[model samples]
Target: MSIISLDSVCKSFGALKVADAITFEVREGEALGIIGPNGAGKSTLFNLITGNIAADSGTVHFLGEDVTRQSAMQRCLNGIGRSFQIPQPFGKMTVFENLLVAGSFGQGKSERAVEQAAADILDRTGLIGRANTVADSLSLLERKRLELARALATAPRLLLLDEIAGGLTEGECSQLVGTIKDIHATGTTIIWIEHVLHALTSVVERLLVLDFGKVIAVGEPAGIMARPQVREIYLGIEV
Candidate 1:
């Protein structure tokens, strides 16, 4: 069954339409990748799905229930967890403290449970060594890992990642891809929006292309990449 569904979702900012009758469904445990040009509204689409913004029309459904009007926190507690492209950890908080907050508030876990979950999440995200380090003191890659870790601390059924691999070296991107692959192995459905094609292709089985805020193509990654329209729009190639 589809864990999340967007039916004819539409949104606009003044006269600029960011989403125009956008519709798609993500099956349980499926890994779907979204790719588009800079202004194609990929992040806006994530915001719509995660309740960061309400759609102007249509419905956003999770587990077959409509949550179009739900707040972002409510959606998080309802099993939607997401990581932004820019890591937004509490600067003064330790890495572990950051996860502790996410577990407690995002997942509504008890203090003890939150502590244990934070520890496990740190270990899983390769941030165990930096547990006591302040979030602001971490390196770029560590910060990115912490961002992903905090999201996992919520124990979400569906994960939304917005360009998590952005601004990373090739080696760093490879390591992050390995971590994401492990996360997917454990049955968490993931929808990732990334411009780093290699990192995205490494993790997602299906790919969706967006152009001018509309879904232009959806299919197996290889097939989607082969399309003339996708190549022209996303890869800057004429075919």
Candidate 2:
């Protein structure tokens, strides 16, 4: 069953077209990876789905309901939790406190009602050790983990991760990938936009490639990456 569907969704900023009639479906409990060069409108596609950007044309359906017109806050309350490409934590808040805020506000629950789940998310994301540390003081890897943890704290049925593994060292990226695999193992649907090809292919069941705001190809990871046009456009390689 599809947990989310986008049909003919189009978006633009003045004269610049960001998403050109983009359409796709993400299955329930499936992990999907999105890949493209910079300015392919990858993040814009995400914004549209999460209601951060409204489509100029077409529809967005979540869990079989039309949510094209829903606001970002409404989408979050409906279980669409996302992490930004840049970590956006409250600098003064401790790691655990960050999760608590996300859980309570994003899920519309009280702090006490979400505490246990928040703690579990910390443990799962490998942030338990840094739970007491202030968000601004965390290392890059820890900040990345906290970002993931905060999203998980909202109890997302569908999680949208934006470049979560982008700046990590090899070992740190591996650690985050392991946590993501664990999340996927528990049947949380994921749509990850990433530049880390190996890390992405490690977790996602399928891959989608975009260029110039259009989906050039999408299929099994190996097949998608092997496509000549995809290689040329996304990797800057000649066939």
Give the TM-score of each candidate: 0.96, 0.95
Per-residue accuracy of model 1 over 1-239 as CA lDDT, tens digit each:
99999999999999999999999999999999999999999999999999999899999999999999999999999999999887888999999999999899887878687898789889978899999999999998788888899999988999999888988888878888998999999999999999889789889999999988899999999999998888988898432
Give the range of the ten consecutive residues with the poorest summed lDDT in model 1: 230-239
Model 2 lDDT per residue over 103-163, tens place: 9999889999999999888887878888899999998767777878998988899999999
What's the lDDT of the predicted structure labeled candidate 1?
A: 0.92
C-alpha-based local distance difference test score of model 2: 0.91
* Candidate 2 residue pairs that clash: none
Candidate 1: segments with Cα more than 4 A from true spot: 237-239
Cα lDDT, all candidates:
0.92, 0.91
lDDT value, residue 113 of candidate 1: 74
